[model samples]
Target chain A: MNKPKHKKLTCLGIESTAHTFGSSLVSLDEENQGTIISDSRSVYQPPPGSGIHPREAYQHHSDVCSGVLIESLRKAKMDMDSVDVIAYAGGPGLGPCLRVGAVVARSLAAYYHKPIIAANHAIGHIELACMLTRATNPIVLLVSGGHTAILAFSNGRWRFFGETLDITIGQLLDQFGRAAGYASPSGAIIERCASKSEEYLLLPYTLKGNDPSFSGMLTSAKRLLSSGKNMDDICFSIQETAFSNLCEVTERALAFTEHDEVLLTGGVAANTRLQEMLTEMCRSRGSTFRVIPRQFSGDCGAQIAWVGLLSYLHGMRLDISKSIVRQSWRLDQVDILWRH
Target chain B: METLIRKGAEADIYKVRWNGLLAIKKIRLPKGYRQPSLDAELRKRRTIHEATLISAAKLAGVNSPLLYYLDKSNYSIYMEHFDGPRIKDVLDDPDLGTTKIFEAVGRSIGSLHREDIIHGDLTTSNFILISDGCLGIIDFGLSFRSNRLEDKAVDLHLVKQTLESAHSAVADEMFTDLIDGYRSISGDESTNRIKSVMRQVQRRGRYARSV
Candidate 1:
C-alpha cells in the first residue's frame, strides 16, 4: 500500500486526560512527516491520598490553559487564524476537566471558523506512538494512571482484546506506594527503590483467564507492605507481578491477533523493567517490539496534535455546533468506514 | 499587538507580538465572588501590582520575561514570551539526568521568594526551560508580593509537595538540589524559614489526615 501524500496542516491539541493539562502544536508536511514545534503541560498534584477531584482539576485547566496554548502557538510561530483545526481529548476522564477542554476546543473552533476533532485520548496516544516508531499491526499495551488495556489494530480499526478488570496498573502502583508512606503516582519512586533491592517477595498475580485484576494484587501488596515486609521487596514483587501480568495479556493478544509486532505506550511504559520484559517476551516469540521514547509515553498534547493533523488530512472533521465533550466516549464508537 | 489566549480563575494570558518578537500578555481577571465594586477595584489594583512585581524581578537581575506593556483599564500586562520546554518535562526525562537543572530551578525560585514574590502555584509547570539553559518563571497569576516568612516557607513547601507527588523517583535528589540552590541565593536566614515552613506544612498535612 502506498502512503498517502500528506499536506501541510497545523493543528492545536488540548489534553486533560488525567492530572496533566497540556497543549501542543503540530505542523504536518506533504510526506505525512510532522514537526512538534511547541508543547507545554501543567500538572495538578492532588494533596497526598486524595483522589483527583473533577472540579478542582477543571479549575486547574482553566487556570493554565491560556498560558499553555499561547506558548505552543508562539513556539510554532503561528496565529489562531493560521490554525487549521482544534483537537482535544474528549472522554474517559474527569468530567469537569474534560468540560474545560471541550469548552476551549469548541470556542476556538467557532472563533477561528475551523473544524473541531474530538479525539479518543487513548487512541491518540497509541497512534502517536505508532507514528513515532513506525510500528504496524502491533499489540498495544496502554498502561497509565487511569487505564490499562491491550489493543490490536488491523483492518482499519483497533480492537480491545483485554484490559484491567479493576484498578489500572498506575493506580495500583500509586495505592501501594501511598500505603507504604509514599505519595501518589509513585511508579517511578517504587521502580527506583525496587532497583536498589535484590530480593523478590511473592505478590498476588491475578491473571484470571485473559482479564487481569489489579485491585486484588494491590490489596495483597498493601498487606505485604503493612506486614513489616521490606519496602524494596514489596516494590519488586509488585513490579514483577504487574509486568508479568501485562506480558501474559500482551502475549495472548499477539497470539489471538497473529500480529508480529507489539508496541507499548502510556506512563507505565516508561518503566525500564517493563519495557525490557515486554521486549524480551516479544523476542522470545520471534516478534517485533517497539516503545516510544519516555517523553512521548505519557499523556502529552503533542500526541493529540499529531493525530489531529492526520485526521484533518483524512478529511475527518467535527461539526462545531454539535461537538461536545464526552466523559465516556469509546474509541470504537466512531465509524471509519468512510475513510476506507 | 496583544491577543487574548485565555482567562483563568484569577488572571488572563494573551499572545502579544512586539517588534518582531512574541510575548505574553497577562491580566488579573476579575473575581465576582468578592464584593462587586470591590472586585473591580481589586482587579485594577492587582494588574498594577503584578506588573510592578514582574518589573521588579527583572530589575533584580532575575531571568524573567521582560515587561513591555501594561493597561490597568483592562487589567492587562504584556511581557516577553519564552519558547522552551517546562522544567517538569526536563526533569521527567530519564536521559537528561542532570542535577544542575534542578539547582537552577531552586535558585530562581529562591530569588523570587527572597524578593518578596510568593508564587502561589510553585509546580514545575509554572517555569520554562529557555534555550539558554536558564529557567524563567511564568504565570504571575497566582503570585503576589509578600515578605512574610510563612509565605516563603509555603513556596518551598509547595515545591516539595510537587516533587513528592509528581516526580517521586528523583524527588529527594531534586528537592535537595533545589534547597541547596535556594539557600545559596536566598541566604541562611531564608533557608531557615523554608525549613520551618516545611515542618509546619508537613505537620498540617499529617494533622489533616488524622482528622
Candidate 2:
C-alpha cells in the first residue's frame, strides 16, 4: 500500500547496480519537478583485459556505499534526519551489486523512520531526464550496455516502439574497445578513434524493422582487429553501422508515436556521435531532440532519487521487507504512475 | 527536381524523373545527431545495402520495386514506383477479398526468407498490390542478410503481431492463410523452425512482462 501523496518531499536513493555504487539526494525544484541535490559515486575500474568481476564490484559497493552516502548528505547540506524517505535501485541489475545498495538503503530507511521505495533503474533514467529537460511523453532512446530500446510513455505505461533483437550497441562498442586493448567503458575512446577514420571497412549491417542485431557486426569488427586492420577505420565502421541502426529504429518509433520530441538517455547516450545522429534524425523529422547531460547520462543514484520522488508523489511504496532486488526487470513492466 | 512523396524517419521517398523515366528516389538522409563524417558513411552504406537487397529479393522470386539507379554520393536510389493501393488499405476494405492478397504476401515473404533476406518491415502497409495483382514489397530500410532461423521466425512474429494489432478484424484469417501459402513454397524444416522460434519469441514477451 502507498502512503498519501507528498508534494514537497526529499528522497535519498542508493544505486549499486553494476560497477558503480553511489547515493543521491533529490528535492522538488520551483517547477514542482524532481531535481538532483547531490550525487556521490565510486566506480570499480578493473585491470585491462580482465573486465569487471561481479563479486569484486559488489565488494566495492559494500565498502564505498557508506562513504558515498555521507558525502551525498554533505553535498545536499542536510543531515541524516532531514531526509523524508529512502529508495534504491531494486531490480533489473547485477544481483550482488544490487544487494549492496538494497541493504544500505534499508538500513538508512529504518534508521530515519522513512518509507522505503523500490525503483526501476530504467524508469529512473527516463524520469530524471524528463525532470531536467521538461520533456512530456517524448520517445526515449535508451542505449546502454544493459539496455537498448525505443520507449514511449502512454496511458501510464512505457511502450516499446522498437528494441534490440540481439546484443546492444553499447556492448558491441565496449567489446570492440576491449579487443583494441582499451580499458572498460571504452566507448568514448573508441569514438575519438573513430573520428580519425576516413576509410570504411565492410561489416554486416543488421537493422531489421526498427530492431537491430549487433553480434554479426561485432564479430566482423573483432575479426578486422585480429587481422591487423586499421583501428580507427574499424571504430568508425562500428559507430557508423551501430548508431545508424539505433537512429533508424528511433526514427521509426517517432513516426509511430508521432511524438514531437526525443530524449536520449543511458550510458551510451553520452556518446557525441550518437547525439549528432539522433539530433540529425530529429531535426529532419521536425521534432525536438534532448540529450541528458553527460553527468546524468550514465547510471547513477541521482536518477533513482528523482524517480523515487516522482513515484512517491504518485502514491507508490515499497515495504522494507518486500524490497528484494530484481536482476531482470524490463522497462515495460513498470506502471509509470508518476507520468500523466 | 524531386517531389516528396513521403518522408520517414530514416529516409525520404521522393517522386523524381530519372532520365525521363517515372522513378521514385529513396534518399537516406544525413543524421545531424551523428558526426558528419560518420553520418555520411552511414547514409551511403544504407543506400548501397538497400539497393543490393532489392536485387536479392527479386532474385529469390519476390515481386518488388526494381532499382534503376543509385547515387552513393548523395545517398539516393532511384527505383520503379508502383501506383497501387497498399495491402493495408485493401485489407481494411470489407468489399475486397483479402485471402488472395494475403496468400501472395506469404509467398513473397517465404521466398525472401528462403534467400536469407529478412524484409525487416513486414507490416501490410509495406506491401503494395500492383496493377498485375502481384504484391510488391517495399521499404528495405531496416532489412538485413541473415539466414539464421531465429531471424526468420521473428519476421513472421512481427507480421502476425502487426496484423493482430492493426488488422484485428482479419488477423486470424490472414495469419492462417499466410501459413498455408507459406507452406506452398517453403520447406518443412524452415516452417518448423519458424513455429518453434515464434513460440519462444512470444513466450519471451510474456515472461518479460512478469519481470
Candidate 3:
C-alpha cells in the first residue's frame, strides 16, 4: 500500500469527555505519521464513595481548560498559532463535559482561523493504540467507562462485532468499588484487591450471543458483598467473571472474523488481569495481542490529536458555525476515510 | 476416524465416521480465559442445550442437521454431516448467491420463532447450503426457548447485524428478501410487530441510536 504524502502539520487536541480535561499538541512528520509532542491533563476527583456529577466535571473542565492548553503549548515550545488544526472530542460522553471541550476548540479555531475537527471519543482510543502499536486491521476490544465494544475495521468504518448489553466493564468495576466505600474510577484499587484473593465465587456469566451483560453480574457481586462474603473474593470473582465474559465474546469475534491481531485499549485496558486474559486468548489462537500503554490507555488529548491529524489530512473540517458537541455519537458511525 | 473441521468460538467441530456413516462431532473446548469450574459448567450446559435445541428445531419443521449421538461426559455432540458450503461463504458469490436461499433462511427462522424457539446465534455462518439448495441451520450452542417478542426480534437483529457487518455489499437486498420471506410465513401483522420490536431491540444496544 502506498503511503499518503502530506505536508507537515500540527494539531491541538482538547478532551473533556468525562472526568479529565486534557490538551495535547501533535505534529505529523513527512511520512504523514503523527507524533505527540505534548500532552497535559487535569482530572477531577469526586467526593469519596460517589460518582462524578456531570455538572461538577464540566465545571472542573471549565476551570482548568486554559491551564491545560497553555501547559501543552509550553511543553511543546509552540504557541497556538503554530497549530494548523484544532480538534475536540465531540460525543459519546457527558453532555456538559463535551460542551466544555467543544467550546474550547471552537474558540481556538475561530480565533486562529484553523480548521476544527470533531473526533469521536471511542475512535480516539482505538486510533491512538493502532498508531502506537502499528496494528493494521486488527480486532479492537475497547473497554472503558463510556464503552465496551469489540470492533473491527470494515467497509470504510469500524464495525462492532460484540459489546456489553448493559453497563460497561469499567462502570461495573467502578460501581463495585463505590459500594465498597471507595471513590469512582476505582479500577486500579479493584485490581489490587482482586489480585490478593484466589477464591473464585461464581457469578452470573451472561453471554447473549456475542453480547455480554454485566448488570446481572454486578447485582450478584453486590449481593455477595452484602451477604458478608469476603471483599477480596468478591472483587476477584467480579474481575474473573467479567473479564472472562469479555474475552469470550472477543474470542468469538476473532474466530468469526479470522483476524490475526487483537488490540486492547481504553481505560479498563490498564488492568493487568484483563490484559493477561486477552494475552492468553490471543496466544492460544496464535494471534498477536497489543495493549496500549497504561499512560495512554485512558482518555487523553493525544488520542484526539492523532485522530484529528488523520481526519484533517483526509479533508475533515468542522466549520465554526457547525462545531457542536454530540453526547451520544457512536464509534461505528464515524467514516474512517483516512485508512485504506 | 475423526478430522478437525472448524474451531468455533465455544466448540471444536470434527468430521467423523460414526458407524461408517458421515457425521460431525462438536466438542465444546475449554476456554483458558474462564475459571476452570465456570468453564466446565458452561461447556456442559451448552453441549446439552445445543442438542436439545437442534432436536426442537427439527421437530419445529426447520431443516437442521439430524443428531446422531450426544456425549455429556466430554461435552461432544455427533450429528449428521452436510457436505455443503456455509451460507456465509456463498451468500455473495454470483454463481452461488440467490435471493431464494435467503428467503428460505427467513422462512426456516420464522418457523423456529413460531414454535417459540430462538436461535440465539443467527449469523449466516451457522446456515449451510445443502446439496439440494436448502438452507440448513447448524450450531445451536446459544439457542433457547423464548416466547417473548423481544427475544425473537433480537434473533433477527443478529442476522441483520451480521449481514451489514460482513456482507455490506448485498446486505440490503438480502435483508429485504429475507424479510419478505419471513412475512410470508409469519404474516405481515406479526412481521411488522416483530420489526418494530426489533427496532427497539436494536436501539437498546449501547450507542445504538444517534441522539
Candidate 4:
C-alpha cells in the first residue's frame, strides 16, 4: 500500500464540445487509474432556445481560450512542461467546437514534443462518470443535448444496450422548454416547473424493447400547452412521460447487464427529479445509483484529460494526423482499450 | 379472501374481498428507487389511469374486468375477479382449443385500438379465460390514449412479438387467427392503414436484431 505500481502520468485535457470550452490538468494514478490531481471547466450559455451556434461557440472558445487553460494549470499548481501528453475531446461534437479542442491539443503536443490523444466526447462523459462514481462495469446513461444512450461496458469497450431512436432526451426536454417559453439548456428550469405541478397529461409512451422515442411525447407536450394546458402541468407531464420511459428502458438494460451500479452522467444529470426516478428504479432492483457530482456532471475538461490518460496508459493511438473531429461518432465505434 | 395472485414491475394484484364481495385488488407498489413525491404522484396517477383505461376498454367492446372500487390513498383498485385459466396457461393447451382464445385476444386488442387506447403491455399473460370461454383483458398499467396508426401498429407488434418469442409452435396459427379477428373487428380500412406501419416496425425490429 505504501507504493503505487506505475509512475504517475500527468496530462492536460481540453474540452470544447458544444457550449463548453475549457481545460484541466491532472496527474492520474498510473496503477488503479483515475486519480484526479486537479480539475477545472468554463461553460458558455446562450439565451434560452438558441443552443450552441457552432460558429459562435467556436468564437467563444477562442475568446476565452487563454484564461481557461491558464486557470487549469494554476489549479494543478504544476509546471506545464511536466505534463506527458495533451488530450482533447476529438469527436462526437460540433465540428467547429471540436476543432478548437483538437487544434489546441495538437499545437500543445507539437510544442511540447509529446503525444496527442483524441477521445470521443460522449465516451469522455462516461469515463469521467465511471471514474468519479467508482462504478465498475455499470450501465452508463449518457444523456446530454447532443446524445442520450444506455451504454454497457463489456469485453473492452462500451456497447449500446439501448439508445434514442429519434431525438436525444436533452433535445426532448429543451424542445419542451422552448415550447413552454424557456431558454436553451433549460433542463433545470423545466425540472423546477415540473415540480410545481402534479397533473399528468396523456402523452405517447413509446418504447420498443430497450429503445425509446421522445419525438411523439415532445410534440404532444407542446400541443397540450398551446391548447391552454397549465404550463406547470405540461412541464410535469413531459418529465413524467419522458423520464418514465427512460427508467423503463434503463430497467430493461439493468435486467440484461445485471450489474449492481447505474452511473448517470452528461449535462441533464443535474435534474434531481430524474435522479429520483433512476434512484427508485435502482433501489427496486437492489442495485446502486451513482451520479457524477453537480460540478463534474456537465461537460468538463477534467473528464477528458482523465479519460485520455487512461487510454494512453493502455497504449491507445496518439497521432495528431487522424485526430479529426467526428461529428456523429457512435459509442460502439470507439474501441475502449483501457477497460478489461 | 385475500390470496396473492400476481405481481409485476409497477403493481401487485391480489384476489381479495371488497365490501364482502369477491374482487381483485390491484395496488401500485412503492418503488424505492423513485423520489418519494414523484413515486406517490406516479402511483396515484397510474392507478387512476389504469382504472379509467379498464372501463374505456370495456365500452370499446372488449370484455375487460369490471372496476368495483378505487382507493386512491393506497393507490389500489378493486375489480371483478376473473375465473378460469390465464390465456398464457392455455395458449398451447392440447385438449383445450386455442384458436378461439387467440381470436378473442385479437378482438380485445382491436377493440382498444379502435377507441385509440393502447394497451401498453399487450401479451397473452394479460388476457384470461372467463367462465363462458370468453377472453378478458386485464392490466392497463402501460395503457394510453393515442390514435396514431404507428402507436396502434406497435401495440399489435408487441402482441405478435410476445407470442412469437414465447409460443413458437403455435405462433403462426395464433397470429393468423389473431389478425383475422383484428381485421374483422377493426375493419379492413383501419387495419389496412396499420399494415404499412407494421411492416416498418418489423423492419426496424430486424435491424435492431441484426446489429
Candidate closer to the true structure by DockQ (higher is better), 1 or 2: 2
DockQ versus reference, model 3: 0.66
The DockQ values of the predictions, listed in order, are: 0.01, 0.29, 0.66, 0.10
Among these predictions, the greatest TM-score belongs to: 3
Better of 3 and 4 by TM-score: 3
Please, what are the lDDT tens digits per residue for candidate 1 over residues B106-202? Answer: 8888878767887655667667888656778876544677888766776676667556544656779888888888888988886977797667654
Give the higher-lDDT candidate: 2 or 3: 3
Q: Across residues A1-340, which tens digit of lDDT does each residue of candidate 1 receive?
A: 2346655788899998778888998787777677777888888877776657777888899999888888888877888988888899877677888887788788888877888887778777788888788886578888888678787653355645555656789889888877776766788999998898867665565543344778888888888777788888778778877887788678756654457899999889899999888887776667899998898888889877877777767778678876777766555454433232
- What lDDT tens digits, residue by residue, belong to model 3 across residues A1-340? 1357778999899999999999999898888677889999999999989999999999999999999999999999999778989999988788999999999998888888889999988999999999888898899999999898888888888887877767999999999999998998999999999999999988999877777889999899989989999999999999999999888888888888888899999999999999999999989889999999999998899999988988988878777898888876878789998776
Candidate 1 residue pairs in backbone clash = A6-A30, A92-A327
**What's the distance in Å from true for residue A208, model 1?**
2.3
Where does candidate 4 stray beyond 4 Å?
Answer: A1-5, B1-211
Over the stretch B1-211, how does candidate 2's per-residue lDDT look in tens digits?
7899877777888998888989899888766655566567667766777898988888999987899988867888899988888877787787655456777888888999888898878877788888655789998766789988888888887787556545655778888888877877896777877888887765554115331
Show the lowest summed lDDT stretch of 10 residues, model 3 chain B. B202-211
Ranking by TM-score: 3, 2, 4, 1
State the displacement of the C-alpha of residue A282, model 3, in Å, after optimal TM-score superposition: 0.9
Docking class of 3: medium
Off by over 4 Å in 1: A1-6, A336-340, B1-211
